[model samples]
Target: MSTPIFPIQQPASIAAAAAILRDGELVAIPTETVYGIAAAPRLQASELLLHRFYDADSWPALPLLLAPEVPLAHLARSNQWAERLRNYFWPGPLTVLLPAIADFPFALPTPCVAKRVPDYAPLWPLLRALGGVLIVGRAAHTGYPPAITAQEVAEQLADDVALILDGGRALFGLPSTVVDCIVSPPRIVQRGIISAPEIMAALQRPAERN
Candidate 1:
């Protein structure tokens, strides 16, 4: 099946992306860090489709892309460090590990959830259209290079994706930094765009504000 590719600037294209997602299909979207394959959070079929295409190691712990305005409490348990990290670096590429609220939809080996709010221009409208949260997974198959452009996404997963939203090449070809706030001191679990010292500073700066 040949998948459709759309420029994210088209209002109708964004609407189409949202529409297919509601029909339990997946869409490939550009993030500041990389292209991602995203699914609607509510539908059972969306979860099944995500797991069908992605495996534990390749797409481990599919993260939530949220609008910055989303209430943190609604998705994660409170942690002062997580809040501080978010306040400083959100609306950009920083994925924070937080304890999932009970009854959170995506079941993982652990109760921890990873969430991010990207600074990318192309995501906001579709994000709001999809209710401010999109379950995002790595766009490439296992052992493949990460997709940074809409064309790269289509090249690799054309049959699997519904629509590829082109927002040009990724702003950063690197991945988002992942911090494990599930632990005390909120250590840097995976280094990507944000530096360790910067994260450590953000974690400690909460004391300065107090």
Candidate 2:
């Protein structure tokens, strides 16, 4: 199936994009790290649809990516450890896992949820427009080589996602460093642009490899 594409420039276009998201459709928006596939929280079915369409076999079952400022309490039971991590390294390239909320959307089901907030300030209004919808999304570089340009997203995901907003290549050429915040003494699951030394200094602990 061919997917729709849109360029993000005027506010009206972004508003239209939000409407598409609310309707359970997919939109690829720009972020500092990479373009992302976004869907509204209510569109649980879209989550599965995205995975199947994109052939993203490595991702967890419940593939929704939350906005960084999204209240942790909304998705999991919070503790001091979770709070500390959130306070320091959010709105950047870091994904923290937490226990899933029972009433959480079921499109992707893992023991914990992977959440992030890309540091794209201009896109905040778009997120606000979506009203904290649980997005079944991923960096535009999901399957293909990492997208360093908007044209890359257009080339790779044009047929899979409903819309693609060309905000240009991300400053960080890599995906967020994923950390298992759900575990005690949080640990790194995947190392990306953020180096081990930086993460260790932030957490003030030695790296724990499983």
Candidate 3:
């Protein structure tokens, strides 16, 4: 099947994209950091997409996004540092790893799960429409850099994906900065636009690398 790239400028495209996700299809969304393939929180499908498209074996612990109204405590065991970071950089490109609550809906590979709130404007409407967790992953092959354009995502994974919400290009061509806040003195698992020093300053302590 040909992957359809919808220009998000049209008001109807957001609803169309939401429908695709609701139907359990992968939709490429343009976030500030990079293009991410998003879907409803289904474990098997998410794992398959990650393996077939991104060549990733990571699951359950895979990066996810809480619905706009969902509280962090519903999925994660939050701490003071997490609260501070979320208040400052949420709805942005910062992914915080926290210990998953025992009853976290999805089956995670580990006890921890990473999540982010993308600050991208066009994506908000679709995310809100979904009204639940959105399982998201970078739209790129295993060894390649994050996909920034819908065309790049199409070319990178061929027709593996179902739809691409083309919002032109991403603001930040890099991926999100990941912080493992589940541990004491939260540490940097992966660095991107947000620097290590900056994260440490926000936490009010030095970060030990994970």
Query: If scored against the real structure, what TM-score would every candidate get?
Result: 0.92, 0.82, 0.88
Q: Is candidate 1 or candidate 2 better by TM-score?
A: 1
**Which ten residues in a row are the worst by lDDT in model 2?**
53-62
* Candidate 2: tens digits of C-alpha lDDT, residues 1-210: 555555566687688888877777777777777667677766454654555444435654344455556686766666666566666666777777777777765534455567776677667777778665446455454456556556776777676667777676778767778777777888888787677777777676322312
TM-score of 1: 0.92
The model with the greater lDDT, 2 or 3, is: 3
Best by TM-score: 1
Extract clashing residue pairs from model 1. Answer: none
Candidates 1 and 3, the one with greater TM-score:
1
Report the poorest 10 consecutive residues by lDDT, candidate 1. Answer: 52-61
lDDT (Cα, 0-100) at 100 in candidate 3:
82
Candidate 1 lDDT by residue in tens digits, 22-116: 98888999999988888888756456555655565533455789976787665678588888988888888899888888877656545666899
TM-score of 2: 0.82
Model 1, stretches more than 4 Å misplaced? 57-60, 106-109, 207-210
